[model samples]
Target: MSKNEKYSHESYLEYQGKYKGIWGWLFSTDHKRIGLLYLYSIAFFFVVAAILGLLIRIELIAPGPTIMDAQTYNGLFTVHGIIMIFIVVIPGLGAVFGNFFLPIMIGAKDVAFPRLNLLSWYIFILGAILAVASQFAGGGAPDTGWTFYVPYSSTSSTNVIFALTAAFILGFSSILTGINFIVTIHRLRAPGMGWFKMPLFPWSLYATAWIQVLATPIVGITLLMVIAERVLQIGFFDPALGGDPLLFQHLFWIYSHPAVYIMILPAMGVVTEIFPTFSQKPVFGYGAIVISSIAIAAVGYFVWGHHMFTTGISYWSRWFFSFLTFIVAIPSAIKVFNWISTMYGGSIDLKTPLLYAISFIFLFMIGGFTGLTLGALATNVHLHDTSFVVAHFHYIIFGGMGFAFFAGIHYWYPKMYGRMYNIKLANIAWGVLFTGFNVLYFPLFIIGIQGMPRRYFDYLEQFHTGHFISTIGAIILIIGIFMMLFNLIYYRHRGAVAPSNPWKGVTLEWQIESPPTHENFEEIPEIKTPPYLFKKES
Candidate 1:
């Protein structure tokens, strides 16, 4: 096929194909377009979930009901957790950025299963629709929380079945995406690009994909069992019938725990890419970083029992899980040290992306330290169901993974859209988000230690002040988020045209045109040097 002249002069945003307008994007098999599909869809759900989170905060701002009743508050938070965990964070980086750049980084035209790539997205959307639809169509919205724990989940009159079904479908979508990535990485690396020569982002995705493939089915089957128990009354989780509730926790966390790595690994991959580019050095300990990614995925599976310590498990099991949890942190700390070492003597750019990456380290450290507290037997007994657990989780997921995602978006914004956002505004947004995030969740940590329980619609008078402060922080954080989103949207159309290699990134994707062509390269480029080589531009 002859290359169109427009492929050189125009971005993918302007390139026309067999179908015109919406239909073109909706049905197109291009990995980049499919990635954007995930981006836009995920962004929509993120906003919805964010709003729900804000409402939850507002309701907790005062001791008494501020916006909704107890039942409504419970339902809202349940939906919020479901949407955020399943729809946003778990698939956040891999589905969006990974799908967009993995093939290009590896010098392939697209993912090995291009059609299946599109199918995975469709399934994700369908699952999201079912989850939301349950709120309006069923007996009521689910009140079992995102975990959908037993007895309560089994007995809830609300839409537990619909929520379970939604989770099940989403798991299928995740598994397909994982399979596509694994096959693409194994089969499609450019000539001479050996296993060690591949970029860190793809390596992280490789590790995450394996976890997704191996671990997600456990949750899929577990959720299916929940649905069966609810419908068929088979009594798997309900003690009144014949099954053990603790068994449900065991099965659930088996997948859910590894699912944590699925959410954070790609985010770490994003940070890995950004550090070397902005710092203008090869990532410190490249082999260590790669091994750490694989190690985290492997060790993550064995630590699920830490989440179940509050339940009555064998004494040895609790200590065993706690030990495994601490062991997982060693590799995590190694990655952190390597990142810091990479920036030690380098000419750092201090761009918005790096700012977010730095912030991720700080926030993730706090989350990690607090996680150790929970991993201990005595501390887990005190903090397991308190707002402390909630605070630590947000610090890791929102503060860690969420910051890394923002870093990826800013670092790749120019490449993805062929334009640059206002740098000053981007930095300002980052500052606000960073400060507001700490203020919001830090107060929760204080109150949680003061004995505030989680998931309570109302709080004790002693905790009211902390709740009030957190609510204000939530508003500020939302403002910063909106500002950042607005800046990106506004600049996509009007911002200055970007250079192909805006970040001076050495990855294969940076060698191609910005917003790369439908067929990424005219001919697959031969790889010679390692991926992280930082050459001084003449």
Candidate 2:
């Protein structure tokens, strides 16, 4: 516990148990431990989902239902999408980074409601287990896709009811975490840390929290209605019972669409933090970036129709959603521009975090531009369910959000663990990931454009070349991910001794001892400027 002594990982757990026990890990309210728990759980889900991804990619290598039957393929993509979106991305926002760093970043003792934060995590785990258990209960996981669109969902042979119910449970966890973060940020700022003075990372969390609180409930009720139709046969979305299937699309996208923003906004926030610090300059458009984040969250709600453009939505609604979709990209573009501007004529440090951040901008740009093409109703008719859409999204989510998550992880790994990862290995891992990710995802773009649909185990011979190339990419990509994990996990104890500020960035976390203490700070420090305002010591 002393500042000079190395923090024992076992010691932290021992202190936690002496004070609380199994109940401590289960019922305690330490944000760092909670964050660590999230870190562990989400990474577990990520691996499972990633394996499913590899399976899907492998099946398509030669085409024609190589692995599982069509029905099983349906289940694979369904569970893959469900676990990745609801279990992995949603909980990750508040549970992992927010839990561990939000208080540390803003100089608070804990979140405004620590117990509620703990409760949120349990609810999330419970919901994840319930969703997984559905695979065994009735029909072995729902095949109605992650969205669980109505008529198919209502009449599907799979355990649609159980799956929808689990999703509803996760929604509550998302809402509570969002609410906890909002209240904490609003009420818990340290002295002299005005709103503008707070770090961009917390500001991004603040924006993301609003999206969670306001948008998540819609999905909660929407899923409940889906369950109602399946169980009680109330028929809100069942056309046979005086309901409209398209209405299901509307209500579903109402939540599902903004849900994507919830995943990416906090990521954008993390990138915002990294760009300035590594560039060693003030954020080029601080006020503009903050406003755009809020704008993206606000405007993100109206564009759900874009996802349903191929579902026979009215032309006017399609046009409106298209316009809104294009408008949404403006804010995101501003962020990218601002990041590049921050690097303009500045001291840009080519460290691991900076490498990931720059990669995020590149991948995000491709995703955003391609999304515009899909948003256009005319172009979307061809690409609606194709690999183009798949490629665009992976680039955005995997390349954009996943990379940002790694960037944050690498940027803070030393501070989080009180140890340094092998810099050579770290760079090598990043190189592998960056190379393999593009190899894995980029060819799907070509395959999709040549008329290959996503989730199809059978494809025409014309797409074979692209599919073959994509498989090679997947192998390399997995290697990259494994290397990154090995260094973080196996190298934790044996890595070089990390100083308090290995990156030499100006954040409150760097001001404290590595791995932090039981309370995060012995004495919470006061900040007079943004966390990334790099100033050389005199």
Candidate 3:
């Protein structure tokens, strides 16, 4: 950065608002501070869920009661899924990076409703607390396997009510954020920035916001129905009470499947930003990527029926869902092709961020293709509840969205914190994390094909080898997780001071001061041309 840029403004970290120390952060409506709050909390839940997942892998190593009993195993996996899916996956990227970067990228000071943004974070915490409290309060931990399917959830003597209430509350937070982002994007762009000229990351968020606004309320009401099913003895999903169990499935997956886009669309946005910067080239087919993001969100809604294939739905329904499933894959595939083409012959940086971005494509492709197998009616019946589905879900969520989270953090660390981490160490952690992920999940596909059902505490001797190998991979994965987290944390406050535009990024965020001032721009920029402009590389 030039000397003129060095002493211009106090970074957000140093800016003292009305409230002093911790209180400033706790009640502040500053979007960057709110984003950091999400970063810390979501990172905590990720490690929490990851530890539960590791213990799960350990228990399955030898097939018969390795570390925990059957009941404990079921409860562990249920809580793990609840936390990872509801808290970590749904809000991690959009709440953290999107909150921090979206306004800045669009040349605004903060989101349209800054106080509403802060309130959403508090609601997220409240819901998260309730979800965790369900494990230990009043009754046994919920064992409905995150699906909380039907009669069992209704009748189970556990804290299912608490979990249900928690999820319901969390949906409110999501809805508010969706509303906030839509208005922010619509009203806050820099003066000459038209929709087409806006960056792709914001476009992905735009599409995702619509899904959040429209789809989340369905599941929120569905959870209330389930709660009523148990407390009011209503016949919502319980068949014995004259309710169709499939009703719950339909309602849940309608929101939950689009919730998949909620998790991934912003992740797609993050990598979309990374690819152009790291490749040192304008994105290939930018308009197509923008369209595909919206396309994926639109098509994602109707494909939920594929998850219910074996539940005895009608033939036409089956064909409709299965067809839509494949159709949805077309847009996702378009994104992958565009990413690769973006890097075709450009000056690829091969940095830690790029590495994770590339891995996301590889693993997400595996997940997407495997998704096809489940989308086919015949194959869906075969793989419906198997370990194969488990592997595919992780490959998509953890491998795709999770890795993209890492990439976004690394790519934006310099700008967000005004410090730099050890590049050599970051790259090494990436390799270990990548290797451990594939080693752990890839085996499940094979064992699942051999007929190992999921949610089982034990398996036959035939599946032992795959389970054992997967367990070891989990161990390696945990080590890498800590290693990566430690490196980032250690450097967050102490690393070398970062330049304003460390990656030579051409976006508005890179043009501003690192750890930007209270008002992002001293004066809002007027955009004259499209984004992703390039200068000669060193």
Q: Please, what is the TM-score per model? A: 0.98, 0.96, 0.98
lDDT of 2 by residue, 352-385 (tens): 8899999999999999999999988889998989
- State, as a TM-score between 0 and 1, how close model 2 is to the true structure: 0.96
Q: What is the C-alpha RMSD of each candidate to the true structure, in Å?
A: 2.8, 2.4, 2.0
lDDT score, candidate 3, position 318: 95
Task: Point out the higher-scoring one by lDDT: 1 or 2.
Answer: 1
Candidate 2, clashing residue pairs? none
Q: lDDT of candidate 1 vs native? A: 0.92
Residue-level lDDT tens digits of model 1 in 1-538:
1221122555567668898999889988889999999999999999999999999999999998898999999899999999999999999999999999999999999999999999999999999999888776758999999999998999999998999999999999999999999999999999999999999999999999999999999999999998888889998889988989999999999999999999999999999999999989989999999999999999998999998997899999998999999999999999999999989888899999999999999999999999999998998898879899999999999988899999999999988987788999999999999988998999999899889999999878999999999999999999999999999999886787777898888888899888777788989999988898887631
Q: Decide which is better by lDDT, 2 or 3.
A: 3
Q: What stretches of model 2 exceed 4 Å from their correct place? A: 1-23, 536-538
TM-score: which is higher, 2 or 3? 3
Q: Give the local distance difference test score of model 3.
A: 0.93
Candidate 1 local lDDT, residue 461: 99
Q: Lowest summed-lDDT stretch of 10 residues in model 3?
A: 1-10
